[model samples]
Target: MKEICIVEFPSNLGLKEPQPGKEPGVKKLPDWLWKHNLHKAISHNILRLDPPKYSNSKDVETQILNANSLVEYAREQAYLINNLLTQNKFPFILGGDCSILLGTAIALKQKGNYGLFYLDGHTDFMNISLSETGGVGGMAASIVTGNGHEKLTNILNLSPYIKEENLWCVGNREYDDEYENEIRNSSATYLSLHELRKQGISNSVKSFLQEVETKNLDGFWLHIDVDVLNDSIMPCVDSRTPDGLTYNEFNELTSYLFQGNKLSGLEITILDPDLDTTGEYTKNFVTNLTSTFNTFKNTIN
Candidate 1:
């Protein structure tokens, strides 16, 4: 365990729609959560980052768009994460959206060779032609691995930031048919939601860990997309679904990462405050996550 640095992704990329618009999965935080007092309650040590407002300045409605300044902005975040980790701090990135992961992942790689475990319901493997919907965020994974647009992959001088062979998608429940064939043909490995529910998250992570240990990776980055949790319990996420991990199931999976010291940094995204009914969803999520990291806070201190 190490000190946790929390970063905030202030950019919305025009994803905050009133009713499932381009900001398809974006939600505004309740005024209460944004209150300074609310920030004090979380248990884990955190560092907050705010990217800036008005990120999607070129065209909010463009189907295939990449943030013009994402690369520079990502580098800023990378710089902070690197400096903190050098000081023995565990940096946790809280997203304006999952797009922030591109920056976070790149920053962690600068540290050394590390296995990338991208936990999301969608493969995020879609490109412009392949994406059912042409949202740039949908192409995040592809963008980072050099599979999508060059402008994005080349952002922050992070071309091929993550080698596809080393990237593993965990709990991909909303698989598009096109992505399925691609996954089968690709070098990346997958542990489906069905497989996880059957074998348990611990078992799945163990398998992945064994592979990493055998290969002698530098460390590992753990990225958690809120969509991985079932919408029944976590309704505030951008992409809500009926079938996903329960809160307890998610807690179990995450606790193991902390206990083993496998997770170096984290990024949580797609939480919009505008859509919340009572602010219960995001509050509960942050609460549970803090509890898991606090169990061994003494080790870090």
Candidate 2:
């Protein structure tokens, strides 16, 4: 398989802190993954970016904490991604939260129009008014599609970081009633967890890829928020939900996604090591991720 570049992003500004000492668990993700040797498993040419310091303060206008900071960080991330792409390197971005999607989307937009393969537990379509906690991570999808606050929607003078029809949301289980109309009206295609289970992951993914092919996209970004996995097996996520895919099911899905080499880049987000006191979950995550990369190597080469 081709070698790839790993980018480390360890910021937690997107989520709100519920308590004084209880910060978001994402800040430690990059180090945790490194300590466990994610770089060794994936590639040797790892480019570690210095993430902005964690900021929990909220924006006065948007009411989302670290709204401005996210934009700044995204711009920096865009520059780094642009450089990597220019050098013809595949970036495997290790993210702090789902909100990092903004930076990735912007970087892809800068190069050309690309599609998005979003795998997450929540739809992340909530607008500022609809988000109960005003977490930017919750509205990342909306922001990328030009449906959220103007400040976030228009980053680096790029409006609509990703086109709606080029986006495909998969493995989603959580839905907000208040924003149900907004989500339903979106042009982006969605394959809910129920639908995926009914169709089976392999078939469902094939269908999604076919749709993406019809769009004639430049390339597509694969975003995987670990919360999409079943809470029983993957319990380190901040937004823990029940009844997600098993390790075998997710591995099968990943193998299929990486086989064809249609992906421009990939991002893995939302694994909080703080919650996993025993470190068993991290070990499991490392094993599964390493196995998936190995599958990609065998299939793509």
Candidate 3:
């Protein structure tokens, strides 16, 4: 375990404009979490990688919105993350959107072979044609796994930031056949919400860890999309669905993952404060996350 570095990537450039003239509020996620004191018990070392200006127009070349800017931001982000890794700091990144995984993935690839623990409501394994809004955030899993346009899939000449076999896509509640097939057809392991419950949360986590050790991977990264929580509990995210992981389930899963420290770091993404008109959702989120995080605080300190 090492000291934690809280990196704020407040960029909504990866999502489509929710409204005609309005941008997604995901960029405010880090601040909202901070406003609720998510950092109170967590580390105080914070860094902000502000994104380039957000745009509504999709790139004609890639047909993904803000493709060029996203690549640029990811490179800068990798620079910061590289520094944190060099300092032996565990990066607890607060993201603007799931697409932030691009930067994190690139950063990890620079070091060595790493695995990905993708926890999200949707598979996010979409390509431009499959994405209705052309939001890169929606295709995060695909890009990181080198399944999308070369521009995003290839960063620093490190295509496939994470090898498919070393990846685990979990907590997907979206029942889209095409989306599910994207990851399912790949070598990456997929565990839908239903499958996770059926097999038991702890069992699912243990299985992933077993694979991590088996591969002798340098380390692995955790990407958590708040939408993985039950819609009844976490409805502030852009894509809301029905039943998902409960608070207790989330805590139990993370507690297991954080044990023994093979994990490189973790990131939280796609929680929209605008949708949570009342801060209740954000507050509850902060409470649960910080509580879970604090359990491992001593090891890092």
Candidate 4:
């Protein structure tokens, strides 16, 4: 079987404090997944990228929390992922938050034109002016698409890591009629949770893959935020919404995405271990996800 390297990226530098003095617990994600046997159930080749100190202070210049640190982290992350790709190993990244997308964006941009399959509960397409919180986590989609502050959008002098037309923002259920206009008006394809259900999960992924083929792009990246799961099943994330895809639908989506040849790598993000004190939700997540990944690997072999 071809290798799939599990990368542990535990950086919470992109989010604001959920309360007065507590940092986000998303940094504990890798450890939590490991305890649940995520590694044992899959490939044992794992690499970890230690994140900088978590800071809640927003940057004066960029107006986003830990913007400078995020930039530095992005470069480091890109270097690691680039190395993995060179070795023909598929990188399965475990993220600290949605902010990790910036690093993957940089790595993919360096290679060639790439598309993005963004699965999240919220658009996360907020810019500095539209964001109520100065969290870069909220602005990741905007930054990667070159719509935010230049420092983040232009990491390593490469701006717009992923082109707007190449992105497909899916599974978003945060139906803010006002704030959602930004993405709705953008060139990137938008498929809300309801629309996805109506279009059929398999059909949605097929359409995205068809676009990748139509563009004749090198490949694409997959970003899965756990909050994309229905809130009842996945409320551990810092940001939550009332609606999302179910585990069955999520499994089908993964199966179809994995069937495609153009998927370069994938990142799983925004699952908080702190909230699942009993570890029930994490175990359920690990079981469902690992099964999907293993099934895909078996098929490829």
lDDT, candidates in the order shown = 0.66, 0.82, 0.89, 0.89
How high is each candidate's TM-score?
0.85, 0.95, 0.98, 0.98
Tens digit of lDDT per residue, candidate 1, span 61-119?
Answer: 33443455565567777788778777877766666666777776677667776777878
Worst 10 residues of 2 by lDDT: 292-301
In TM-score terms, candidate 3 sits at 0.98
Candidate closer to the true structure by lDDT (higher is better), 1 or 3: 3
Q: Give the Cα-based TM-score of candidate 2 against the true structure.
A: 0.95
How are the candidates ranked when ordered by lDDT, highest leading?
3, 4, 2, 1
Alpha-carbon lDDT of model 3: 0.89
RMSD of each: 3.3, 1.7, 1.1, 1.1
Best by lDDT: 3
lDDT of 3 by residue, 162-213 (tens): 8878889999988878878888899999999999999999889989888889
- For model 1, the superposed segments whose C-alpha errors exceed 4 Å read 14-38, 41-48, 52-63, 297-301
lDDT of 2 at 183: 67
Error of 2 at 92 (Å): 0.5
